[model samples]
Target chain A: AQSVTQPDIHITVSEGASLELRCNYSYGATPYLFWYVQSPGQGLQLLLKYFSGDTLVQGIKGFEAEFKRSQSSFNLRKPSVHWSDAAEYFCAVVASGTASKLTFGTGTRLQVTL
Target chain B: DTAVSQTPKYLVTQMGNDKSIKCEQNLGHDTMYWYKQDSKKFLKIMFSYNNKELIINETVPNRFSPKSPDKAHLNLHINSLELGDSAVYFCASSPFDRNTEAFFGQGTRLTVV
Candidate 1:
């Protein structure tokens, strides 16, 4: 079965601290990876995606993620956390040629503390 | 302007009542989808339509039906609503084929009484 996992249900980081959110996925074929952010009472917004080429991808709001094929991980990272960065982050995947049916992880809620 | 929009941002209905949620995307994308976000905040795909044709249907109840009048619109209708059916329904759209990122609507919160 294909699935995505976000090990941490919630994470807290003080403002200006480095942050990392872990994600792992199980898929049969080459995977199309994505990260989305959702704020309170708001819709999901695409942060970044990994399809091919470079393993490291940069996203909006100074966020970036690296795709590690060996470990089946695509962890999100940021050099410094901001209070506004506190939101629910989701990792999603779709099998190649699957017609955009995304398999989403359980999501990680980031709580930034000042 | 919203790239994707879903009508009835909040809906509260009685059990066994039928209701529908409409979705529209103006990004000129070829694919649309409906996702359910449960109380636990787990998001799951319910249906996918590409070019107004049903492409993917997950293990959803038969009471839930999705309709696509065009490539830019997808609508979901539920019959005989139940308590477990109360959830946040999100509509999203993406471009056709590989390496596409989906745009999501504000989501509709459904409550069953």
Candidate 2:
């Protein structure tokens, strides 16, 4: 079974600080990976995705994630996080392009402080 | 404009009462889904429909019925609601398949008294 694990349940960082949210997946083969953000009482918004690429994928709001095949990880990173970036982050993996059912992680709640 | 929307954002009902939550998407996507988020914050997929056809049905109770009228609308009807039925239900739609990012609704909070 495909599964995703996010060790950090919650994280606190100061404004303008670099941020890194870790994500790991267990799958039989290379699967479609994605990162999404959700604000309180709001729906989820796609942050980034990785399929077949240069390993480093860039996304909206200055967010980026690197696909480390060896490590089975797709960790999200941002050079500088804005206050508006405070939200819950989720990492997901689909079995394949055709069997597109996503398995999501528990989620990481990010808190940005001044 | 809301891409995906669900009606009755908050629902409070009795344990034995039956209720249905409506969902619609204007993105013209071919696939729609229903997910449940438990009190422990664990999100799980319950049902999925593609072009009004049932595609994926997880290990959900038969009391939970999902109906898709068209390619853009999917509704969830719960029968004989129980205390465990109290959770946040999310509706989502995707264009081609799950490979693409799935657009989600604001979610509906269902509480069984």
Candidate 3:
């Protein structure tokens, strides 16, 4: 079974400061990785996805993620975060064969300070 | 227009009552799914349908039933809802291709009191 682990339960960052949310996955084969953001009372929105090639994947709202095979990790990064970026972030994984079945982590709540 | 939409964004009902959440996708995707987000913000797939055919049914309780009348619509019906069932339910759709990403709806927050 494929599982995603987001070790940070919550993170607080000052506005305009750099941010990184760590995500680790355990899968037997190559995994399809994704990052999703959910605002308060809103549904999850796809930030970006990693299918193949180009380990460095860019996403919406000036966000990006790097997939490191050796570390079994796909961490989301931003050079600077805005107050609106504060939300619950989830790291998800899709097994090689099962595309529709997305296994998500417990999620990381991001709080941006002004 | 919303790519994926679910009816009754907020549903508050008493325990032991039955309710249904309807989902429709305008993206014309072939696969649709229902996902549950618990209070702790853990998301898990509950059911999936491909071309109106049941494809994946996770270890969810039988009280939770999903119906797909067509490829573009998927509805979830819960029977005798329990307090534990209070969570946000999301509907999503995606192409049949393995590399495609799923588009999610606004979600239906079901509260059982």
Give the Cα error of residue A101 in candidate 3, in Å. Answer: 0.9
Off by over 4 Å in 3: none
How accurate locally is residue A64 in candidate 3, as Cα lDDT from 0 to 100? 99
A1-114, model 2: which lDDT tens digit per residue? Answer: 899999999999999999999999999987789998989877788899988868999999999999999999999999999999999999998865453677899999999999
Score candidate 3 by DockQ. Answer: 0.78
Tell me the TM-score for chain B of model 3: 0.99
Which is better, 1 or 3, measured by TM-score? Answer: 3
Docking class for candidate 1:
high
Question: Candidate 1, residue A63: CA error in Å?
Answer: 0.4
Which tens-of-lDDT digit does each residue in A47-72 have in candidate 3?
Answer: 99999999999999999999999999
Q: All models, DockQ values?
A: 0.85, 0.63, 0.78
Kindly provide the TM-score of model 2 when superposed on the true structure, using C-alpha atoms.
0.96
State interface RMSD in Å for all models: 1.0, 1.7, 1.1
What is the DockQ score of candidate 2, to 2 decimals? Answer: 0.63
Which ranges of candidate 1 are over 4 A from the true structure?
Answer: none
In the order shown, the candidates' Cα RMSDs to the true structure are: 0.9, 1.3, 0.8
lDDT of each: 0.94, 0.90, 0.95
